[model samples]
Target chain A: MSLFTQSISPETLSVATLARIESQGGIDPFASPSHPPRVSAPSFRLPARAISAITLLALIALWWLAAQYKIVSPVFLPGPEAVFRKFITVARDGFVDATLFQHLLISLGRVFAALAATLLIGVPVGLLIGLSTVGRGVFDPLLEFLRPLPPLAYLPLVVIWFGIGEPSKVLVIGLAMLAPIALSTAAGVRAVNEERIRAARALGASRLRTVLHVTIPSALPQIFTGLRIALGAGWSTLVAAELVAATRGLGFMIQSAAQFLVTDVVLVGIFTIALVAFALEWAIRTLDRRLVPWSGRD
Target chain B: MSLLELDHVSVRYQNAVRDAVADASLRLSSGDFLVLTGRSGCGKTTLLNVAAGFVSPSSGMARVDGQPIAAPGADRAVVFQSDALFPWASVRENVAFALRMKGVPRRERDRRADALLARVKLSGFGDKPVWELSGGMRQRVGLARALAAEPRFLLMDEPLGALDALTRERMQTLLLDIWAESGTGILMVTHGIEEALLLGTEVIVMTPNPDTGQQGRITRRIPVSFGRRYRAGEPVRAIRADPAFAAARAELADAIFEGELQ
Candidate 1:
């Protein structure tokens, strides 16, 4: 009785009703009237992880083949296995007079020293140039002149002044790292929206308060970008500085190994540098994600 | 005393050959809504900027509450055409920035920002990044940011010009609602004549700079008062739709665009 009251049989329905029912079966509302079939948006495709793994395997195979066939001398191009053996030897017997931990500590210490000094000087100068018309007028030209000079160019002069010591090394690397950071910071500062500045002023904020609350917070992402660039510069500059006149550190080991033509040792040092650079880069990316959580995903 | 007054104010940029605005004077009372309408480059922006103390007059002077205006101050707040929210900040952070500058504590500043955002119909958008917002939503955030300061005067320069037609209409009604609640003095600049007619309590039609000639010398100036203060003399839409607006508009257009004011 309930079924009879609530429903009509398909056979009993009229042609118009049947057509409406048929339309409900498969017709998409969004389909264009002129087109027989609906147009669907193309879905995005991501590169598969399996593809990346295969690429890695292919690269390793090529390296092994080159080494095994003597396409390059073993002295110059050690097989992956040989390189791994050297790595295990270093891990056990150390790279030089110092252990692996000692060399790492020295490198990390140098980087930290240079970074600290750069931050101390770069941020204030950047903010000054960014915020003040007078400061920009005075300092911008000076900065532009200094920014392009490579850090290696300063080593000879720094050595003459500070004489083959850690101080000279630190000064060279720190100054090299300073330019990009300060410039990027200034750019960030200048790019702060004028509306925010005006609004801050309208709220009875003193000049100092405006700079502190509005300007600095707005310019932070750019400042972080500068720091990342500066870190890279410092790392590369540290290696170059160490290469010139150093008794310790990975760069020194590479330089010493190159002199003796111990390509295996040199290769080991090169691999270590690459590994450390990768680690530093990964740390910076993680820092960026954490600090600027709203960094333009859209 | 008039709440704000412009005394023979004229502005000329240093490189420009002619004054952008010449010998413009007006008196505005508190709670008054003033709309400025003219041909492009007839100096509507220059006049509003001078009034807000963003730009100085090349000649004459401007006064607020009988005091001579000199620089941008807390008394006047501006809503810009671009809706320039800081892209790096979340909507809440952007709204709270002005308050933070004024030394408001963190708790209070956040509270006030939330309230202001609510006023602009953007209550839950506080934590959203600016880049994630649509154009209309960004402009609403801008309006809320400006209103957060609670200034004595509000200066808007084509604040809704970037929005689509439907959004623009909605924004206009929203602005009217906010105005009714706040009662702050407003000076708005727009190229849309109908918008001026709909929004202004007092409408001032500006003439383009004139050259010496019979037609050029006869620049029309009319004051439109509407609604409760209509004075039983003129119909608002009829006055706006009248042939006089067209003639004035054309004459100003010729003066500005053709440089043949006469």
Candidate 2:
């Protein structure tokens, strides 16, 4: 008898082979590699966290030394302490007659509003494109045209169309965020396994039920990936949007501070944007782990 | 009365010059186990798909209970070779999916799913994710899911094609037991000659159409009674080891080979 047939039960052999394949970083036996893996129960990685913190502190120290030693002019590169002081000042006295929180909130509000709109409109449109040839014919060319154009390239047109107001700013950011969400959702829908769809149909699922229950759930991981990408794109576009026209927002605050050569305030704005963006990504990643736990494992 | 029937069916895909399935007719009544055996591209699957209502016949008709098959419905369930259980759902939930789709209440669906799982020898495995199951277990789950729909006719396309020899034997026995207990008509397509003789109440041998040079036409229909012996109280292993069984299997194999040569 073959070794596979001789020693152990076939079930055990198959399970062992699957585990071996998984250990080798082969395709997951349970989930597709494209989907997210189930999250393991939370465990503290204090050593890794310490190392990350140390690296950040070391970079900040190097920046401080370079500024203090005048290796780069303080006017161009403010020290971390200077930025910290500016943060306090901005919190107390405000910038451009708006408090720091107000600026932060306004920028946040714009990006989030755009994100919400993208999810609402882009997801359905993307699903349509992914599921049906007619939907693809209708929207593919339009999205293709929009996707490659940089947000700034269309900023002038947006301002002209919507005027230099909240609508214009929101519109630009929304447009910037829309493509990834739609594209990813479409990709996700298309990526749904043919067998799964067939199984659903065999189980007496209507076309609508198959799309809703099978297609939507299968496409969720890719959609989450798109959401992450769109959030980043939207944040970057917020700066450009504010630069064009905005009375409030961190983007406006930084641009206005740059005119006065207030390098400290500019640095603070940049750091705050980075921090918020990082937090947003982390939150989404955590949610993805919880929501689509069946993604990348076998 | 036939549970499912295909009358002189031919399936020709658009833009294809010849039919995939040509002038093939089949009937499956309750408690009947019909196995269609042929080599690849013989259009056995296309015929199955036609009967399942996934594909409409280009020229002829497929019906269930005298009603024309327009599309896929709950009356006919398919078990695929891939064991396409939903990875996102737990074992119970996967089995319960058909019930849920049919608007069965949650409590009843769970009860039916659990009972089906037990019938398939997967009791207490309800909460386990499908991906974690072995190939045989997955196929069992797939079978349970198919049964959950309470289908009148079970159509399988190479359902045990992926399993190892031992697992395949085990699955064959399991299939027999399920068939005896459920009494649902089964129409399965496979390439294995021995599998056909061993499991089938009637074996239909398909070959390329001699006249049209198309993909498939039924060449022979052989009635088998050995499987009923197992139902009549003989052990499967003894039945398999019997000389009569071996003779039947060899005859079927030679017949299929002769068709291939022709």
lDDT of each: 0.72, 0.85
TM-score, per-candidate, Cα-based = 0.78, 0.86
lDDT of 2 at B211: 53
lDDT of 1 by residue, B94-191 (tens): 78866765678999999999999999899899989887898888888887887887777888888888889788867866776687678888888877
lDDT of 2 by residue, A92-200 (tens): 8899998888999999999998899889999999999998999999998888788777778889998888889888888888997777778878988988888778788
Instruction: Output per-candidate TM-scores for chain A, rounded to 2 decimals.
Output: 0.80, 0.81
Pairs in clash, predicted candidate 2: A29-A298, A30-A298, A31-A297, A36-A296
Worst 10 residues of 2 chain B by lDDT: B253-262
Find the 10 residues in a row with the least total lDDT in model 2 chain A: A1-10
| Share of the reference A-B contacts seen in candidate 1 | 0.54
